[model samples]
Target: MDTRERLIESTRELLWERGYVGVSPKAIQQRADAGQGSMYHHFASKEALAAEAIGRSAEQLRAAAETQLSGPGTAVERIGAYLRREREVLRGCPIGRLTQDPEVMAIPALRAPVEQTLAWIRSRLARVLAEGREQGEFSSRLDPDATAAMIIATLQGGYVLARAAGTTEPFDQAVTGTLALIDANVAE
Candidate 1:
């Protein structure tokens, strides 16, 4: 990879592994195998680089979600595919983890991508649910917007629960339960 790409990728990994406060420019330089001059030449500051890295992470997250969400299937089936997709559950959601970082949340530039990405996911899910309702796959009682938010909550909370217990069981259970709930709501 080019020096710029290396720096961004290194920052992305560090940010995911070590929250905002824990990551340092020196650490990023070493991980990227680039020097201080190269980093400064690419990014004006640590926060600037972090913002770029976070934005890239958010873009990847959105694209991944879109893959399962927009794939051919019933709404619930598509959502189930999304929830069940393989993930590094122990590592937690990259963007979601950033919400816990005081520095990231305190900085609007760093937080914007995280916020926008989540909102987009929620909105996309809601659209899928709404389409399912229109297609008679879901009952009229199903609230697309509310259920979309719930799905996101369950996923994010599952990560926290799994990390707290140092296992992926909690996350697995959360996803299973969520899929069951969605299935239960299918039109009779």
Candidate 2:
């Protein structure tokens, strides 16, 4: 791969494996197999490179979610598909994990993509829930905005539970329970 591409990819992995504070230009260059001059040539600073990489990761996350949300199925089924979609559970949500990092949370440039990506997810999921409500697939009592926010929280929280326990059972249980709650609310 080209130096620029290599640098970005390396940073992405490093960011996932280690938080923003843990990453350094020298470490990135070593991981990318690029020299200092090459690294500097493509990016002005480590934060700039990280911003590009985080943005790319956020876009990928959105695209992956879009696939499930847009797929042919009822709203619950689409959401269930998203929740059940295979993931590296133990590794945790890339963007969500970043939120726990002080550096990422403190910097606007670092945080914007994470914030926008999550907001996009919540908005899109809300749209689906609203559609379901309109079609009478969901109970009239269900609030789309609240339900969407709960789903986001549950999914991300599941990752934290699973990672903390060093087992996937917590994540699986969360998904199943969330789905059961959704299914229980189905309109007669």
Candidate 3:
């Protein structure tokens, strides 16, 4: 691949592995096998390169989520499809992980993509819940926004628990529990 693409890909991988504080420009250059001058020519600095990489990851995630959200099915079915979507639970959500990075949170430009990505996912899920209510697929008492937040929080927190436990079981358990709750709320 070209130097620019190589650099961005390297940054993305490193960001996923080491996070913002743990990754450095030299490390990215080495990983990409590109020299300092080449990297600098393409990116003003490491932060700028990371920003671009994060943006790409965010866009990719949004697109993947849209596939499930727009699919033919009841709202709960589509949401279940999304929550059960194959994921590297141990590696964690790239966008969600950024929320824990001090450097990322300190910079608005760097944080925007991450925030927007999660917000979009949550909003999409909320819309699905609303649709389910309209169709009487869900109980009338269900609160879409609150339930959406809980669902997203559970997913994000599941990643944290799984990463700490060094296994995917915690993540699976969390998804199962969440699905059970949704099922309980579904209209018979």
Candidate 4:
């Protein structure tokens, strides 16, 4: 990869692995195999580079989710597919983990992409839930907005629980419980 791409990608990995406070410019330079002059030449500051990295990660997350949600399936089926989609459970969600970073959230520029990505996920899932309800795939009483929030919360919380326990089991369990709830509301 070129210098700029490598720097951005390196920053992305470092931010995912280390968060804002833990990742340093030296670390980014070393990881990207770029000199200090190269990094400064491409980006004005660490915050700027970190923002690009986080934005890239957010876009990837949105794209992956859109594939599952937009493909052929009932609303519940699509949502189930999304929930059951393979993930690095132990590593946790990159965007979700940033929510725990005080420094990232404290700065609006650093936090916008994370906030926007999560909002998009919840909104997209809500749309699918609404679609399922309209098609009689799910119960009429199921609130799409609330259910969407719950699903996102469960996935993020599952990551935290699993990371804390040093296993993917909690994450898997969370997915199972969420699927059960969605399944329970399936139209007979």
Candidate 5:
């Protein structure tokens, strides 16, 4: 990879492994195998580099989700596919993990991508739920906006639960329960 790409990739990995406070320019340089001069040449500051990295991660997350969400299937099926998609459950959601970092949350530049990505996910799910209701796949009593929020919460919370327990079972159970709830609301 080029110096800029390597730097961005390294920053992404480092940010995932270590929060904003934990990542240093030196660490990024070493991980990217780039010189100090190269990093400074590419990014004006560490925050600048981190913002780019976080933005890249957010883009990837949205694209991955879109594939399943927009794929050929009923709304519940598509949502279930998204929930069951292969994930590093133990490692946690890349963007979701950033919410726990005080530094990341405190910095608007660093936080914008994370917040936007989450909001996008919720909005996308809400749209799909609305579509499902229109098609009679979901009951008219279902509230797409609220259900969408619950799904996102379960997903993000599932990651926390699994990471805290040092196992993937909690995440799996959370997803399964969510699927069951969606199924329960299936139109009669």
Candidate 6:
């Protein structure tokens, strides 16, 4: 690939592997096999490159979620599909991981994409819950927004738990348990 594309891709991979605080421009340049001048020419600074990488990652995540969200199924079914979708549980959610980075969150531009990515996922879940209510699949009393937040939180937290334990068991259990809870709440 070209220097610009290589730089962005390298940054994305490094960001996922090392996080915002851990990654450096020099490392990115080395990973990209591009010189300092090439990288800086494309991105004004490390933060600028990271911002672009985060934005790209966010877009990719949203697109993946939309695939499951728009598929043919009931609300819970679609959500289950999303939760069960293949992922690198050990690697963690690229966007979610950014939330743990003080450097990324401290910068408004860097944080925006991360925040928007998570908010979109939560909003999508809430919309699904709303649809379930309209279709008599869920109780009218169930709070869509709250439920959505809980679901997203469970997934995000699952990653943290799994990472801490150095195993995928916690992540799998979290999904299983969360799905069971959702199923239990569904209208019989």
TM-score of each: 0.99, 0.98, 0.97, 0.98, 0.99, 0.97
Q: Poorest 10 consecutive residues of model 2 by lDDT?
A: 177-186
Tens-digit lDDT track for model 4 on 17-96? 99999999999999999999999999999999999999999999999999999989778778888988989888899899
lDDT of 3: 0.94
TM-score preference between candidates 5 and 6, better one: 5
Give model 6's TM-score versus the native structure: 0.97
The candidate 6 region of ten consecutive residues with least summed lDDT is 179-188
| Superposed model 4: Cα runs more than 4 Å off | none
lDDT for each candidate structure: 0.96, 0.94, 0.94, 0.94, 0.97, 0.93
Output the lDDT of residue 13, model 5: 93
Regions of candidate 3 where Cα sits further than 4 Å from its true position: none
Cα TM-score of candidate 5:
0.99
Q: For model 4, what is the error of residue 116's alpha carbon versus the real structure, in angstroms, after optimal superposition?
A: 0.6
Candidate 2 lDDT over 1-188, as tens digits, reads 89999999999989998989999999999999999999999999999999999998899999999999999999999999888999988999989999999999999999999999999999999999999999999999988898889999999999999999999999999999989988888899
Worst 10 residues of 3 by lDDT: 179-188
Which candidate model has the greater lDDT, 1 or 2? Answer: 1
In angstroms, the error of model 4 at 108 is: 0.6
Off by over 4 Å in 6: none
- Clash totals for all models, in order? 0, 0, 0, 0, 0, 0
Candidate 5 lDDT for residue 154: 100
Writing each residue's lDDT as its tens digit, candidate 3 over 1-188 gives 99999999999989989999999899999999999999999999888999999999999899989999889999988999999999989999989999999999999889999999999999999999999999999999889999999999999999999999999999999999999999989987
Q: Compose the digit string of candidate 6's lDDT tens values, residues 71-161.
A: 9989998999999999899999999998889999999999999998899999999999899988999977878999899999999999999
Prediction 1 TM-score vs. true: 0.99
